[model samples]
Target: MHRRSAVTVAVAAALALLVATLTVLTGAYEITPGGVVSTLFGGGSGTDRFIVWEQRLPRAVAALLVGVALGGCGAVFQSVARNPLGSPDIVGFTTGAASGGLVMILVVGSAGSQSVLVGTVAGGALAAVTVVLFTLRRGLGGDRLVLSGIAVGAMLAALNDYLISRAPIEAAETAKAWQYGSLNAIGWRPVVPLAVSLALAVPVTLALARSLRALELGDDAAAGIGLGVTATRVTALAVGVFLAGAAIATAGPIGFLALAAPQLAGRLSRAPGIALGPSMAVGALLLAVADLLAQRLLSPFQIPVGLLTAAVGGAYLVWLLTRAPRREGARGAR
Candidate 1:
């Protein structure tokens, strides 16, 4: 299993690197691989500088960062929930962040991009807390928690629809592409906020990982082994929500990477539970590749990255659903 995981991690890293390279080279105004390398070192032609530095680089960075964030957040959520299905995308976290982003885009039209990110953070955190409060009766890591998240997410999605409907056309127009999660209009400015968010969330999550492993043994066993079950759960949830929200802030809640990446990583690595590092690598690869496709799939008429992810992820979700029961039955037999 260890050897398998190592190979999986290596392959995932290679894939991410390849996808990043290809995304940098692709667009309506395509740059050669040689040109992309030169542009990164500040030696490309003026057109390359404007398109590569000002346009594609930041978008690519945002896609990569958001993917990492979602991947890490998904692993944490799945661990906390003790279910493979527990992901920010399937739960309320993404919707909460989206709702907050929509409000910022529509209601606070005058506020800057910074405000939009803040709103996303607030929305995601609030939604996570709300889900916790409602499901605490049954406790975390239960089917009840998953169902509650689905419920809350549905409600927030409805609110998002209503908000979009009531907003001015201009504001709604801006929100429309965001609603589907696009990396079309990114820049260095947006990258700064997301960087800050990741810096804050990632280290904290890593520190809690040992505790998370302990908690997987169950509260009684974990506490007996010196883990602060309640505190660990809270910390994990906070970090997970923060990462998910920040990703949404940067890229408008691109879904399924969070839902799918960790599970895929776990399977590939033969992890008994979700593996964070491998998951992040897979997610970065997935979104970067997805973004690359989003730009070139329709060529000059680019579609939203979120739209493509949604279609693909919806199909993945269906597959997971059908596959889950058989896996569970096998485990039961074991």
Candidate 2:
């Protein structure tokens, strides 16, 4: 890694840790920093232990893990598509995962976390298959892949709306809340699954990072260098799909963190290719801080972290779109 990239990753990690510590201290139960420390080390009273260890800590960890998962997925998608707008949020994978979870919530009437997770994975896999089929003829890079993903994502979004509309009133309400992407009900159950998914994904992503970089030079160039272009693209997509599914299963498809993390990491580090490690660190920081603000920003009402991310991400998208031409022009000039 470049020195600046390493420094960016380190700083983001530090900030994420600080924000997570603040999250642990900011809940209604109100443990002091000292109390949180003592409880973490097995010294505080029973109430302190339950509040700090059980309640607050789990939420913090969930935010961090989910952010890491989304961050890595975003880096992979953008690299594969060779487009800045190719993150899962725009590409339909996140929407597909959300649709699956909605199916379990509304159609099957089994809103249990595990059932929802299964649905998310199935839905995401289905979406990946659909995209692969769509792009099989034209291939997986440049405009074709991104356009196919956007079309699939749009259809899935509409399907999600239709399902919500047709559901019973109570179930509809529950489904609507889930659509907002919350970590409020998070526990160790979801966190463990997310961690395991990352453990499996991170190594594969790192191994393929070289191939993905070569791929950025175009498929012919990549293939010329002995990279299995088709195989690498397929593997990267699978990893990205699994990461998106696992994250949505854990936290209901928190928006825009995936879209913005890699772009921001790239700029902060000024790194030429995808800054996967820095992006994950930045993602961890962004989501942890967003969740913290979501909790404390409005006080007693408590906004959903997804809504917060959407609001911020929407603005970021607008800015990115406006500047894209200029950025592209600059790149062409160079």
**Per-candidate local distance difference test:** 0.85, 0.89
Output the lDDT of residue 329, model 1: 98
- List model 2 lDDT by residue over 227-306, tens digit each: 89999999999888888888998889899999999999999999877788888899999999999999888776789999
Clashes in model 2: which pairs?
A: none
Model 2 spans with C-alpha error above 4 angstroms:
43-46, 328-334
TM-score versus the correct structure, for each prediction: 0.94, 0.95
